[model samples]
Target chain A: MNQVIETLLQHRSIRRFTDQSLDREQVETIVKSAQAASTSSFIQAYSIIGVTDQEKKDKLAELAGNQAYVAANGHFFVFCADLHRHKIVGDLESADVEDSIESTEKFMVALIDAALAAQNSAIAAESMGLGICYIGGIRNDLEAVKEVLKTPEHVIPLFGMAVGYPDQETDLKPRLPLEHIYMENEYQQDQSLFKKQLQDYNKTTSEYYEERTGGKRADTWTGQMAKMLGRKSRLYMKEFVENQKLNKK
Target chain B: MNQVIETLLQHRSIRRFTDQSLDREQVETIVKSAQAASTSSFIQAYSIIGVTDQEKKDKLAELAGNQAYVAANGHFFVFCADLHRHKIVGDLESADVEDSIESTEKFMVALIDAALAAQNSAIAAESMGLGICYIGGIRNDLEAVKEVLKTPEHVIPLFGMAVGYPDQETDLKPRLPLEHIYMENEYQQDQSLFKKQLQDYNKTTSEYYEERTGGKRADTWTGQMAKMLGRKSRLYMKEFVENQKLNKK
Candidate 1:
C-alpha cells in the first residue's frame, strides 16, 4: 500500500493531545482539503465553524460531555449540516426552494456533504502529522451548542473535531472483520453466517480490550453497542432537528 | 503540502474510465482503508457492497439512470447505511435496540459512517492513480435498488462510487468561498456578506465552466442550485425511508 493508504489505516482517535496547536496555514490547508470534497449537485449545503474563542471552546468542551480535548486541542471545528445558504440562494434568485430544502433527501444531502468534508479535513490534519478525534458528544446539548455557536435555524452542528499533536499513542482499535463489512453484489443476509462472524469478532474485540486493559475489562462489541444504543440518549435529536426546520419532510 | 493532502485537493469526479479493472488486492486495500474510518460509539453502523457480478453491475448502471461508468469501472462500491447488523447484535445480546436503531440519530450515524468510509475509499483509490466518482443517481429509484441489490430492512444504499483508471481528467470545480463555508466561533449569518461571497464564487464557477466548455455552459452556482432545488425531485425518499423501518421516530 502507498503512504496515503498507510496513513488512513493508521487512524486512531486521539483523546489526549500535547500543548502544541495548529497554525493558521495548517488550518487553511485542512479547511481547503475539506472544500475539495464532493458535494451533492454542488449544493455546498454545509458550513464548518472553527472555535477560536477561549470561552466558546470551554463551553463546547462542557457541552461535549466534558471532553477537555475539545477545548484544549490544536484546533476545534464544528461541522454543521447547513441548508440556510440554500434558502438565501432561493431568496436571491426568487426561486421557491422551501419544500426542497425541507425534504428528507436534501437533509440527507446536507448531512452527507458535511461528513464528506469532515473526513477530508480529518485526513488532511492527520497527513500533517496531527492527531484528531471526532466529538459526537457535541450533540449532547444542541440547544446549548446553538447558543454558543449562534447557529441559526436550518443549521445544525452535527459534530465537532479536535485536532492536535498526539500526547500518547493508542493501540489500534480492531475493526469489524472485512467479510462482516463488505459484501459482493447482494447483501449477504445469511443470518447463520452473519451470527458466526460477529461471534468471532466479539472474541477478537474482547481480546483486544483485555490485552489493552491488562485484564481489567474485556467486552464484546455487540454488548457495548447494545448498552450504548438500548439506553435512551440523544432522544431529543429528532425533535431538535425537526424544530430546527430540517429533516422534517 | 504532502502527497496525501495534494491527492485530496486534486479530486475531480472521473466519469470516464479505462477498461482496466481493480484487482482483488486493490479492492481489499480500498475497503480496508474504508473500515479504518471513525464510527460513533463503535457502532460501525455501515457496510460496503462491492458490485462484482457483471449482471448486477449492468442492472445497477440502468438503475442509476444509465450511467455507463457505473457498469464498467475498475470496481463499483455501494456505501450502505446499515443498522441490520445492530439488530442482529441486539438479538444476540437480547438487548431492546429497536427504538434506538429506528431513531433519527442512529440514521444520521449510519449515513455519516457510510460517507466517511466512502471518502476514505475514494482517496485510497485516487492515491493509487485511480479516479472515482460518486453516483448519487442510485437514489433515482430506491425500490428498484432494493430489488436489485436485495437490501434488507434498516439497510439503505446511500450512494454508489465508480473507481477505475482515468480515461480523462477534469478541472477542479470552484467551491464556496472560505469565508462563506468556514466561520470562526459562530455561524456568520450575514446575508449581505454571504451573498457577496457566493456571487463572487458564482463568477469563479462561471468562468470555470466557460473555460472548460468553451462558453457552452456559463451558469452561476446559485442559478444551478435554484434550478435544481427549486423543483421537486425524489419526493418519495421521505416515505421510503420510513417504510424501510428507519428514521421513523
Candidate 2:
C-alpha cells in the first residue's frame, strides 16, 4: 500500500488534543478536498460551518452530550446537509422545484453528499499528520443545535469534525470480518453461516475491549449492539427532520 | 498541496475505462482502506458487494440506465447500508433491538458508514492511478438490483461504484465558491448574499460547460438544478426503502 492508503488505514478518532491548532492553510486543504468529492447529479447540496467562536463551541460541546473535544479542538467544522441553496436557486431561476426539493430523494442526496465530503476532509487532515474525530453527539439536540448555529430551514447539521494535534492515541478498533461485510456477487444470507461469523467477531471484539481496558471491560460486539439498539436513541430525528422542512415527503 | 490532497482535488468522474481489470491485491488494499473509515458508534453498519459475474454486471448496467461503465469497469462494487447483521445479532443475543434497527437514526448511521467507506475506497483507487465513478443510477430500480444481487431484508443498496483505468480524461468541475459553502460560527442565511454568490457560480458553470462542450452547451449550475428538480424522478424511493425493511420506523 502507498502512503495514501496507509493514511486511510491508520485513521483513528482523536478525542484529546494538544495546544496546537490547525492553521487556515490546513483548513483550506481539507475543505477543498471535501468540495471535490462527487455529488449525485452534480447537486452540491452541502455546506460547512467553521466554528471559531469559543462561546458557540462551548454551547455545541454541551449540546453534543458534553463532548469537550468539540470545544477544545484546533478547529471545529459542522457539515450540514443543505437544500436551502437549491431552493434559492429555484426561486431565482423561476423554476418550480418545490416537490423535488421536499422529496426524500433530495434528502438522501444531501445526506450522502455531506458524508462523502466529510470523509474526504477527514482523510485530508489525516494525511497532514493531524488528528480528526467526527462529532455525532451534535444530533443529541438538533433543535437547540439549530438555534445555537442560527441555521435556517432546509439545512440539517448532520455532524461535526474536530481537527487538531493529538494528545492521545487510540488503537485501531477491529471491524467485522471481510467475509461478513464483503459479498461475492450475491449477499450470503445463510442464517447459520452469518451467525457463526458474528459469533467469531464477538470473540475478537470482546478481546479488543479486554485488551484496551486491561480486563476492566470485556464486551462482545453483539452484546454492545444489543444494549445500544435495545434502548431508544434520537427518536426525535424524523420529527426534527420534518419540522426543519426537510424530507417531508 | 501534498500528493494525497492533489489526488482528491484533481478528481473527475471517468465514464469509460480500459480493459485492464483490478487484480485481487488492488481490491484487497482498497477494501482494507474502506474498512478503516470511522463508523457511527462503531456500529460498522455497512457492507460491500463485489460483482464479477458478467451477467450480473450487464444486468446492473442495464438497470442503471445502460451506463456502460457499470459493466465495463475493472471492478464493480456495491456499497450497501446493512442492518441485517444487527438484527441477526439481536436475535442471536436475544436482545430487543427491533425498534432501534428499524429507526431512521440507524438508517442514517448505515448510510453514513457506507458513504465514508466508499469515499475512502475511491481515494485509494485514485491513488493507484485508477479512475472510479459512483453510479447513482442504480437507485432507478432498487428492486431489480436486489433481485439480481439476491440481498435480504434490512440491507439497502445505496450506490454502485465502477473502478478501472482511465480511457478518457475530463476537467475538474467547478464547485460552489468557498464563501458560499463555508460559513463562520453560524450559518450565513442571508438570502441576498447567497443569491449573489450562486449567480457568480452560475457564470463559472456556464463558462465551464461552454468550454467543455464546444459552446454547444453552456449550462448554469442553477439552471441544471432547476431543470432536474422540476421533474418528478425516483418517486418510488421512499416506498422501496420501506419495503426493504430499512428506515421504516
Candidate 3:
C-alpha cells in the first residue's frame, strides 16, 4: 500500500486533545486548504466560523450536547451552508432576489460544498500532524445555534469540528467490508454476500465495544442502528431550515 | 504560503487532460484518501465507481451533456450516495428492513458523505500532481446512469469526475469576497456591505471569464445566477430521490 493509503486506512476520530493551541498560521493553512475544494460552478456556497473565544466555546459546548471535548479543543470550527452571498450579489446587481433562497438543488449544493471543504481541511490537518473529530450534535438545537452564532438568513449550521494534538492514542474503528459498499456499475440487490460480511464485522465491532465499555456490549451493529433510525435528532430541521430561508421547495 | 496551501488556493477546473494514464497505485491512493474522509456516524454511505472502459466512458460522456473531456480523460469516477449496503446488512442480521431507505436525513448524510469523500480524493490527486474536474451533469439522465452501471435500488448517482495530468495550464478562478462567507458567531444580514463586496468580485470575475472564453464580457455573477435560478434542468430530483427509497420523511 502507498504511504498515504496506509495513513488514511488507519484513520480514527480523535476526541481527546492536548491543551496545545493552533497558531494563526496553522489556522490560515487549514482554511486555505478548505477553500481550495471544488465548489458547484464556483458559487462557493459555504462558510466557516473559527471559534477561539473561551466564553463562546463554553456556550457552544453546552449547545452541542454538552460535549466537554468541544469546549477544550484547541481549534474549533463551525461549518455552514451559506447562500446569503448570492442574495447580496443579486441585490448589488439590481436583480430581483427571492425572499427565501431555498430550492432542492440549491440546498443540496450548499450542503455538499460545506462537507467537501470540511473534509479537505480534515485531510490537510492530518497531513500536518493534527488530530480531529466531527461534532454533528451542533444541529441538536438549530435555533439556539443560530442565535448563538448570530448567523444571518439563508445560512444554516451543518456541523462542527475540533482540531488539536492527540491526548491519547486510540485504535482505528473498523469499517464495513468492501463488498458492502463497492458495487459494480449499478446497484446490486444481492444481500446474501452482504449479510455475511456484516455478520463478521458485527462480531469484530462487538468485541471492540465490549473491551472499550469494559463488560458492556451494546448489542451489534443492527441493534444500534435500529435504535438510531427511529430516534429524531433533527426533528425541527424542516421548520428551522425554512426559517433560515432554505429548502422552500 | 505553504506550497500545499498555494496549490489549493490556485486550484482551477481542468477540463483538458493529457493522454497519460494513472498507475494502479495512484488510483488506489486516491480511493483510500477518499475512504478516510469523515463520514456521518461512520456509516460511509457512499461509493465510487471507477470507469476505465472506453465504451462505458463514451456512453457516460454522452449522458453527461456530451462533455468531450469526460471520454478523453485518463480516469473517470462516479461518486454515488449508496444505501444498498445497509439493506444487505439488515438481511444478514434477520432484521426487519424497509423496502425503501429514503429519508431526508439519510439522503442528506449520503450526499454529504459522497461529497466529502470525493473532495478528499480530489485533494489527494492534486497532492500527487493530478488535475480534476467534477461533472454534475450525471444527474441529467439519472435512470440511464443507473441502468448503465447496473446500480441496484437505494443508490443515487450524485456526480462524475474526470482526473488526470493537465494538458494545459489554467489560472485559478477567483472566489466571492471573504466578508460574504466568513460570518461571526451569528449570521449577519447586512445587505449593503455584502453588495459592495459582490460588486468588486463581479468585476474581477467578469474579467476572468472574459479572458478564459476569449469573449467580450459575458454575464457577471449576478447575471449568470439570474439566468440559472429559473432554468429548469431535469429537477424531477424529488421524485427521483423518492424512487431511490430516500427522503421518505
What is each candidate's DockQ, to 2 decimals? 0.88, 0.83, 0.42
Where does candidate 1 clash, by residue pair? none
Task: For residues B72-106, write the lDDT of model 3, one tens digit per residue.
Answer: 98788889988777665555555554522455666
Among these predictions, the greatest lDDT belongs to 1
Off by over 4 Å in 3: A1-10, A94-100, A207-220, B1-7, B94-101, B210-215
Q: On lDDT, who's better, 1 or 2?
A: 1
Positional deviation of A79 in candidate 2, in angstroms? Answer: 0.6
Question: Using Cα atoms with residue i matched to residue i, what is each candidate's TM-score against the true structure?
Answer: 0.99, 0.99, 0.90
TM-score of chain B of 2: 0.99
lDDT of 1 by residue, A194-214 (tens): 999999999999999999999
RMSD of candidate 3 to the truth, in angstroms, is: 3.0
Q: Supply the TM-score for candidate 2.
A: 0.99
Give candidate 2 misplaced runs (Cα > 4 Å): none
The per-residue C-alpha lDDT of model 2 at residue A159 equals 95
**Backbone collisions counted per model:** 0, 0, 20
> Model 2 over residues B1-249: C-alpha lDDT tens digits?
788898899899999999999999999888888999999999999999999999999999999999999999899999999999998888888988888887777888888899999999999999999999999999899999999989888998989999999999888999999888889899986878889899999999999999989999999999999999998688788788888776767
Worst 10 residues of 2 chain A by lDDT: A240-249
Query: lDDT ranking from best to worst?
Result: 1, 2, 3
